[model samples]
Target: MSTAVKNQLRVCLLSVQYNIMREMVNKVTFLTSVGFMVLNNAAILAQWFILLRLREDVGGYTMREIMLLWGLTAASFGLAHILFARAFSLPELIIGGKLDAYLVQPKNVLVSVITSSTSVSAIGDFLYGILLMGLCGLGLREWLLALLFTVTGTVIFTAFALLLGSVSFWFLRMDMLEGQVVMGMVSFATYPDGIFEGVSRYLLYFVVPVGMAVYDPVHVLVSFDAAMLLRVLGYAVLLTAVSAAAFYRGLRRYASGSLMGARV
Candidate 1:
């Protein structure tokens, strides 16, 4: 790779390391927070277990598949928050004109903004996902697919959040709407694809991307179709491209808050 590219990667890594170290300073609080998050995520599985007992399957998903769904969703959610926590706060950053600091930085502004913070609890979510895969007794191929799906899902989640948060630059009072969209994606991701039909399915697959992020991954775990996997990957790439384009486009219109003047 070029020296410039390598330097960029190095800088990003340093930022992540520094953020993690900062979070680790409060050792007890960090550990408790992470542990509690894991327990809380695990507790959600109980409801699924109970629901599975009531019927042979929900939306054609067996208990095993449901476990994989939860694993993929939790892992992706964890990875997004842990790494791209600042992306979710884009509406706030944009509205408050906090992008000025990042604009003055040598690094990419979007990257700098998104990686500015780390969610310690998300580490627990990632670990739980790995544990869930083990519980699924997946073979090597299946395990690899799960990992690929998790990564793809993470990218989709982050890109979608960027897309939603970018809307703040164009319109007022979109903060609550942005939160609702993220929450909606998260809620739908945990459910079965069979539950949705017609336009809703298309929306999930293309518009909101919960399908590519979670539903499609579940399909891969069950069937292992190469074409379907490629489709999901293609969607992730397209979404990332679109989100990046939209964010930069909106950045041009961002108004500098008075806080920027106070920074000096």
Candidate 2:
């Protein structure tokens, strides 16, 4: 790899490590946050279990397949938050002039900003996801595919958040719209793809891209498909590029809040 790429990666890793350490300083709070998140996710999964018991399947998904769907979704969501938690707060930062802290740093502004924080509860979601995937009885190949899907899914999710949050540049107070768009994507991703049809299905694949993030991954896990895997990776790359371009384009319009504060 190039020296610049290596340096950027190193900076991101250090930022993530520092954020995690900072969150862990309050051990009790850290544990409680993580535990509560695990319980919250489990409660949601339990609803599916109760519903599945009554019916053979929902949208062509049985108990095991549903597990895979939830597993992928939770794992990807957790990983995204763990690595790029600040992406979700991009709108607030833009409006509040928090980007000023990142812009002055000797690192990629977007990377520095996004990696500057960590979500303690996300560790719980990641663990719970692994537990669910284990219960699904995946083979070695399936396990590898699941891991790859998790990474791609994380990229898609974080990129989507950045894309939505970038709107705060041209428009003022876009936090609500950004939250709704993200929530809508997550809400649709937990269910089976077979349920949506026509326009909704198209929107899932193109507009929100949940189909690329979750549905296609679950389908591939059920039955391996090289072509589908390639498409998922392609979508991830495309979305990342678009989001990065949008962020830089918007950066030119950014006005400093002129508030002075130290990151440390």
Q: Who wins the TM-score comparison?
A: 2
| 1-264: candidate 2 lDDT, tens digit per residue | 599999999889988888889999999999999899888898987788788889899999999999999999999999999999999889999999888878887878989888878899999988888888999999999999999999999999999999999999999989999989898999999989888999999999999999999999999999888999999999999999999999999999999998888778
| Model 1 agreement with the true structure over 55-131: per-residue lDDT tens digits | 99989998889889988999999988888888887899888877888899987888888988888998999888878
**Model 2 spans > 4 angstroms off:** none
Per-residue lDDT value at 257 in model 2: 98
Q: Write down the TM-score of every candidate.
A: 0.95, 0.97
Q: Could you tell me the C-alpha RMSD of candidate 1 in Å? A: 1.7
Q: Say which candidate scores most in lDDT.
A: 2
TM-score of 2: 0.97
